[model samples]
Target: MKHLLRKTTAWIAGAVMAGGLMLPALAEADTIKIALAETPSDELAAFFVALERAKANGLDYEWTAFSDEELAIQAVLSGQMDIGFGTPYAAMQRSRAPIRIIFQLSKLKFFPVTTTKYEELEDLDGEPILLHSRGGGTDSIANVIEERLGIEFGERSYVPGSSNRVAALLGGQADATIIDLSNTNKLMRSPEADRFNVLEMFEVEASDEALFANLDWIQNNEEDVQIFVDALLSTYRDMHEDPTIIRRETNPDGPIGQLPEQILGELDGFYGDAVDAGLYSKDGGGRVAANADLEWYSAAGQLEGDPSDLNIEDFWYLAPLDNAMN
Candidate 1:
């Protein structure tokens, strides 16, 4: 009887030990939450690719859809999100929270979409315009327009998404708006296509969406951060080589795939549209480093010193991207 009791107790003790060992794994398995503005534009394709690679690296992730990039950055700054996507310039210079852009996502290639009344940037001097968000990518482009053409938009309105801004224009709620390739393509296919004209705009010195995290949070989660960055570098290489890889690897049941059926079916169309719009590159070697230098010059006012005098090293740490790329 004593021997049998001893054996049973030993089995229970072993089971408890095994369960204890799994506790940390279960805790570590908690989803790493990220946030980004709505719309799966080509600029953000690398992230979807990273998510797929992240799973294989034992990192689980969930994403939150924000109305705009500024809000997404706010989420990360507030600690409500583990990571979020946005241009590194504003967050680095404007935000109160300490955050860093660990990965370079892409560059902005925005064109001005205006009514027939406005043929050029000069025509917009006294006109109202809609943008994706205030103090965001579109706003930055607007600033560039004012600088280049010496014309300032009369009234600036903040509409959150490219689709939302496009709809507002189509519905006659706004006269003109800036938009991305995805919505730009959709607008051309709509009945109001003839109502607006896309103006030829120069490339602005702005980096597109990038992965950002609260500095402290990132330091504590170093391993996970390395894993995420590695996946991003790998995915970026593949996306540059063949943009179609994203569509093929998209989880039909996952968020990227769970996009409205229409959008899903038109994935290739969007990719092609973006490429035609000069929003993406086929070379896959995105101008990550050079663009950062240009961005510094453009955002000179935001920095304390002249861009020519400022050290790029103070703002960017390419070690992460370099490590991942290697």
Candidate 2:
């Protein structure tokens, strides 16, 4: 299947060489190779729907799930993939790869969760916290919180997943941290949920996950790129207008379709909540998101320059999305 949700591999060449495992052959020259940062889930139902629409329009593609977002960015930078998923603001600034984001898949829709000891962000001024990684999205959220709220944290620890981190909280390991929408929902609904609080977060419009590609490749594959963006814009708009469309359009034979009924049952609710929360923008975040990304990423310590001084065109190619909207 082109949408191989679980298509993980030995991440590096050295790992493959050492393990002597047979890696799948690379995609054909004309095929669009997509690097997924994580396994497909209900959150990606709309994205897979867009891919299906693009395929019907003659888009040829295959996807591989990388172990993490950074690996996906590296794959695209190494020319092993044509398109990738990540908010690669740091990579775009630090590397000369000409990588430009084409679509903002989702925004920084995270929430601050803490025990009753903390009622708001200000309450954790000098408290220790847990996050996904040191330089990842959640870590950047913490950084931005400190910058915007004028408070400094005590210690930052890494725990990788929200389920695990919430357990850490249960075990009295940490009191406060940032978590995604789904995990926050799960935590707040648990038996011991009364002990936790979902802090009121300021509106964040910055991109958390986006579709990016090398400028050269994007220029060379303009037609396919337009098709892909057109499909994505259509899907995003439709989902926002009527979030249930995601579940309706999900392919029964695709990877997302193969998910267990328990998980699949949550598609409509998940996307509806996402739409209600404004996790996605109708125009795939052409200029507004790019600008917000500059401010947010700069505050998060991912991008070095002042938000106002950095050029949006340097990080985002808004033409495809603009064209799609028009």
Candidate 3:
């Protein structure tokens, strides 16, 4: 009897030790890895807010920023990252990456600004235009313009940074450039504001950024993904109802907080412009935005085939987002 009791106690102790080891694994499973197409900026303020909320909800996450969208997409494809930022339509169509967009983050709110001499898009005919890069958002915009307006502008790509593009425009390196919302606002407020004019460009009914992940990983981590989407959807709703929520949730120690004071000060204005421009979707988990993305990307030549034939359900996994929304 004494021998049997000793053996039972030993077995119980071993089982407890095994369970202790498994605890860390379970905790680690809750963490998600995210990849950013670019460094954090004022435009991603609400996303940062969602990150904070996710932390509170026990969904820990880490993010890495690549220099460009291509690198970010590659990281996700190789499984080096769990979630990537941009929707690589061409890459997806060609390589058949098992990636599905889970969330539509923002819309294409880009603007074309040029020297005062050019008053409209028509005036840019045959003129050199500074673009973000080949096969990038700015390039897509240029392609759409050429197709719609039946005019071709010489393309010059020196750097991918919007500030660099803005500098090129201000320094007269290029007569016209397409820049982001923040830079557009900065130029409008600059002392040289009168020297430039923001030409009206056609509105792009497409997503500027999205949350995409490997299909297998998404399937395995559906619960965690739902938590993340829930947090993000709530944050978006909060922002739409009260734009000031962005300022209220600004974490001084977070990524956006580390920005230069000049940029930081412009956060309100940047968000204000975004809000006025309807850059964000009110239906956080609806398919309307996804359908629009297909049409816009197809028109821009980013994706092959007709937009009407492409089913958005193939590219998007709406379950997680829909579950979060409800």
lDDT of 2: 0.84
Q: Write the per-residue lDDT of candidate 2 for residues 1-326, one digit (tens) a residue.
A: 24532223322221122236443232323668899877777767899999999988878788988756888898997777889988888999998678999999998899999999989899989899998765778888889889989999989988766667888988988898888787788778889899999998888888888999988778877988999999999999888889989889999999899999987888888888888888888889889999999999999999997899999999999889889988
Best by lDDT: 2
Q: lDDT for model 3, on a 0 to 1 scale?
A: 0.78
Alpha-carbon RMSD, each predicted model: 9.8, 5.7, 9.7
Query: What lDDT score is found at residue 112 in candidate 3?
Result: 89
Show where candidate 1 strays beyond 4 Å: 1-30, 39-46, 94-97, 189-191, 275-304
Q: lDDT per residue, candidate 3, 179-256, as tens digits?
A: 888788888998989989999988786887888887767887777788889988988888888777887787898888
Tens-digit lDDT track of model 1 for 1-326: 00000111111111123433421111222457788766564445557777778778877667778878878877776566777877656456566545666765655766688777778778888789998776677887787678778788889999877777887887789878888767776787788888888888776534555677766566666777778888777765675566677788887766566667776677667766655555543222234543554454365333444566655544554556656655
Worst 10 residues of 2 by lDDT: 9-18
Relative to the true structure, candidate 3 reaches a TM of 0.87
Backbone collision count in every prediction?
1, 0, 0
lDDT of 1: 0.65
The pairs that clash in candidate 1 are: 240-284
